[model samples]
Every structure is written in C-alpha cells, then in structure tokens.
Target: MAAPSSQIDQLADRIERLLVRYEELQRTNALLQQQVDSLTQERESLKSRLSAARARVDALLERLPTLKNAA
Candidate 1:
C-alpha cells in the first residue's frame, strides 16, 4: 500500500511539472510567432523598395537608346 501511494504521488508531481513546462513552451511559441510576422512585413517592404528601384533602372536604360540615336 505504501509503495502504491508513493508511486501515485510521484506521478502527480510529474504531471504538474509537465504542465508548467508546456505553459512555458506556449509563451515561447507565441513570441516566436510575433517575430516571424514582423520579419515577414519587413521582407515585403524591402521587396517593394527593390521593385521600385528596378523600375527606375529600366527607365534609365530605355533613355539610353534615345540618347544614342541623337548622338
């Protein structure tokens, strides 16, 4: 009977510990998710800027053809 009681108490303690660890993991996961969202937004902003720059470069290249004809 004593052995059984001890085993039950140990199991209870393990369950409590596992619950606490799970909570900690949940908080960490939430933080990581927020960071990923922020990074994705930043990536999109950079992509937009890059696209604008490429367009400007293409416009400049197109002008070069006209300039060459005038020369």
Candidate 2:
C-alpha cells in the first residue's frame, strides 16, 4: 500500500529542511577554515617584522661605542 499524499508531503518537507541545515554547516566550516588561514599568515608576518626591528636595534647599539669615543 502507498503512503497517503499528506504524509509524503510532510516527509519531503523534513528532508528539505535537513538538506538546508547541512548546507549551512558546510558554509560555516569553510568560513572557519579561511579565518584560520588568515590568522596563520598574520602571525608569520608579525614575526618577520619583529625580527627586522630587533636587528635594527642591535646595529644601533653596536655603533654607540664608536660615537662615545668620538665625542
């Protein structure tokens, strides 16, 4: 025996809702992955900048003795 038309319609609606929720979850996962990638790149860039700044400071410190002798 076949299911009543009303029951089949209800099942179809439930399936459609589940599909929509699945799609939403997929989109959320993709966005989170992008955020992680962006944060990783930013961290690397900050580390590079910090290293360059430290090198500049070290060079200036090395010149201090010569400047003191010349004064």
Candidate 3:
C-alpha cells in the first residue's frame, strides 16, 4: 500500500510539472504567431510600395520616346 501511494504522489508531481511546461509553451507559441503576423504585414506593405515605384518608372520610360521625338 505504501509503495503504491508513493508512486501515485510521484506521478502527480510529474503531471504538475508537465502542465506548467505546457502553459509556458503556449505563451511562447502565441508570441511567435504575433511576430509572424507583424512580419507578414510589413512584407505586404513593402511589396505594395515596390509595385507603385515600378509603375512610376514604367510610366517615365513610356514618355521617353515622346520627349525624344519632340526634341
């Protein structure tokens, strides 16, 4: 009876430790997810700016021929 009771206590202690670890891991995962979302938004903004810049460059290039002809 004593041996079984000791084993049960040890198992309970282990379970408590595991629960604490699980909670810590959950918080870390949530923080990582937020970082990923922030990076994704920043990447999208940079892509939009790049696209706008490219369009401006293309428009300027299109006008070069007309400018040259007028000269």
lDDT of 3 by residue, 13-65 (tens): 99999999999999999999999999999999999999999999999988777
TM-score, model 3 to reference? 0.84
How many angstroms is residue 56 displaced in model 3 relative to the true structure, after the best TM-score fit?
A: 0.9
Candidate 1, superposed: residue stretches over 4 Å from native: 66-71
At residue 41, give the lDDT of candidate 1. 100
**Regions of model 2 farther than 4 Å from truth:** 1-11, 66-71
Q: What TM-score fits each model?
A: 0.85, 0.66, 0.84
Which lDDT value does model 2 have at 2?
61
Best by TM-score: 1
Clashes of 2: 0
Lowest summed lDDT across 10 adjacent residues in model 1 is found at: 61-70
Model 2: how far residue 15 lies from native, Å: 2.9
Which lDDT tens digits does candidate 2 get at residues 1-71? 56799899989999999999999999999999999999999999999999999999999988777865988
